[model samples]
Target chain A: MKIIARVLIILSAALLVVGATMAFASSASSGSGGIGPGRDGFERRPPAGAAEGSRPPGFLPGGAFGRGEGRGDHEGGRGMPAAFELLKNLVIIAVIIAISTLISRLTDGLRPQRR
Target chain B: MKPEHRTYIRARSNLLIDVATFIAFLIATAPRLSGIGIHEWLGIAFAAAIIVHLLLHWQWIVALSKTMLRKARASSRLGYLLNLALFIDVTLLTFTGLMISEVALPLFGLRLPRGFLWRGLHSTTSNIAVLLIGLHLALHWQWVLKTTARIFGLVRPTAKPRQEVSQ
Candidate 1:
């Protein structure tokens, strides 16, 4: 269990970095495009050479800094429902708690067993 | 088992939670990184954990306040002031953050015409909170290191709570 917990933490940390990078890959490739979340929790960048009125798939009108959006998870019509967002947050909390527990437990393993 | 050892374990547990929540806060504060959905949820979770941290230290907080009121040491007074400021800043930050939330509430189709100012306020106050937390940690550096050592068995838990000599 301790090993599994450690693996979970390492994988989640790695995934968080990779996932965030991939999510931003589009906007990073596109000049002057803001990074925003897609409906499926991945990021959607402005399409290549998109004009003012034209938006890429899952791109919202205002983008990340726009008035209608504020670092939101889903975009336009493709977004996961709000209920799902809550669930995702719950999952995040669970993962964090699990990681904390596992770490403490692992340290507990190092302690001298009391008679 | 000694009662103080129990307190030591409990304190270490709370500190562990505090550290974990801080890391989560760091990740979720990035608008682009965590997206709206994750950031809002993380914010809520962080807030809940902060409350728990405060509660776990309630006795110390109360005792510190009494000492401060009774003209306690300057260090105790400073610590108390720092904690109070941190609490206020976090409260303000959380309230402003939720006010400008775009994903967490809007998922429920609840939209409030949050002012553009909320964005700026939330960012600035959060930065301040971060700084305050850093200072708080630095002030307790000895305790952090010693307690962490105890937790990892590099040293045994103190048989008695350390005297508040600095306080």
Candidate 2:
């Protein structure tokens, strides 16, 4: 049982690492083309006539960034009010880290302390 | 009989179930890979795995919830919260996934009326859910390992319920 547990854990860890790296890499390479309401890459060129801070019309899937999308869109985009596309990636990274830490602490508590 | 062993068993079982489900999910989402027919079958398989996984963990879920309600410990509360988020995300992923129409599954004579909102929701939720799952694994990595070891019979189960099962 112990051996199986160890193997599963190792396998899961490997999967986790591979999965996350794949996701991050895909997101990075695919850029904004995959989904979300933002530019097509890491750096937005900002369409012609669009101001630095102002998002152009039709920039997002639906006109007016948070207007018609569901909570998933809101949460997925990190709920940045749609105006701050620059902060979108940052928000996602932060959320991942925060959730990871919280989960770690909780799971840690579930296990009995080792002597 | 040791606590570490118990912990290992529990964790390993959960991980095994999760991995199985993950594979199914990957198959289901394959259609997204090339907009092919293989995706529909995969989707069905994925959904089945989800049901199985849920059924397997039903007892733990009930116990976890009951414990949470009784004492409201910070850890238990956090687990419940994460569980809730995961549930919502997975539900949305499955829901939205089914919403998307595919040419591959047309032969099966099964269809769901396509909804633009559903498609949008599905894509967005899937992205978020993937991230959440990653975080979930990262947080529980240690337990995941301990359990895997036990499942493989490489280590004995913990004698007590409270002992460091793994370094």
Candidate 3:
């Protein structure tokens, strides 16, 4: 019962944040006359290959949802193979871990040594 | 449960939760590889996972909060601040994600207005979260290793590090 209460509190807090964001977004869009508060004027559109009605609602094949207009060319399927994309992300993470470890070590070294 | 046994169980749970959250983050980051559908759904699930993660460490969070501005060590204070920033960033990420949701929300019979600002913020926060996660993991890397070793029966139950509570 205690666990359940904690979960409920977290969920409620999250929902409150979500509600605030939605209200902000609604005002921003309204103020901009549907240009969507995008300084670059990028419009929100369905991805070109989404085939909205053709597939199951929330799950799509690799070729379908991640391609075309909604995002930049680099984020779509046209740029790289799936495996390569995953590899690239993993490599970024590896570099981040290395950098983080180095910073940690450097900080630890700065502290006075114990007798 | 014996105190040592209880500690072991907690350690195991933390390790599992951390690993799962990290994998989910990796997959969510590579939207093109996992497809936008999986990305959206996994991102929502990831939010839930994060809540659980925080709950697991709630006692520590409470303890640190009381002392963070008073007598907590510099590292603990730093970790707490970083965690606070991460929490705020994640809240923004989830909110922007929902605002620009393409798949998950639509499936639930709800559709938010198309906001290019929200989309931009979503992408930005997603990238920022990668760095925060890296730092978060780095801070807890020792705890992770020790817990894993204990779990595998390669190490005996021993004194935990002083800063482990911040983890």
For chain B alone, what TM-score does every candidate structure achieve against the true structure? 0.89, 0.72, 0.93
The model with the greatest DockQ is 3
Largest TM-score belongs to which candidate?
3
Residue B41 local lDDT, model 2 = 61
- TM-score of model 3 vs. true structure: 0.78
User: DockQ of each model against the real complex?
Assistant: 0.04, 0.06, 0.32
Q: On residues B76-132, what C-alpha lDDT tens digit does candidate 1 reach at each position?
A: 788789887776676656765666677777778976553333454566676676567
lDDT of 3 by residue, B96-163 (tens): 77766778988889866555566667878877787788778777777878888888999888754334
Clashes of each: 3, 46, 0
Candidate 3 - chain A - TM:
0.61
Q: Candidate 1: which docking quality band?
A: incorrect
lDDT (Cα, 0-100) at B147 in candidate 2: 66
lDDT of candidate 1 at residue A52, scale 0 to 100: 60
Query: Which one wins on lDDT?
Result: 3
Higher-scoring candidate on TM-score, 1 or 2? 1
On the 0 to 100 scale, the lDDT of residue B107 in model 3 is 89
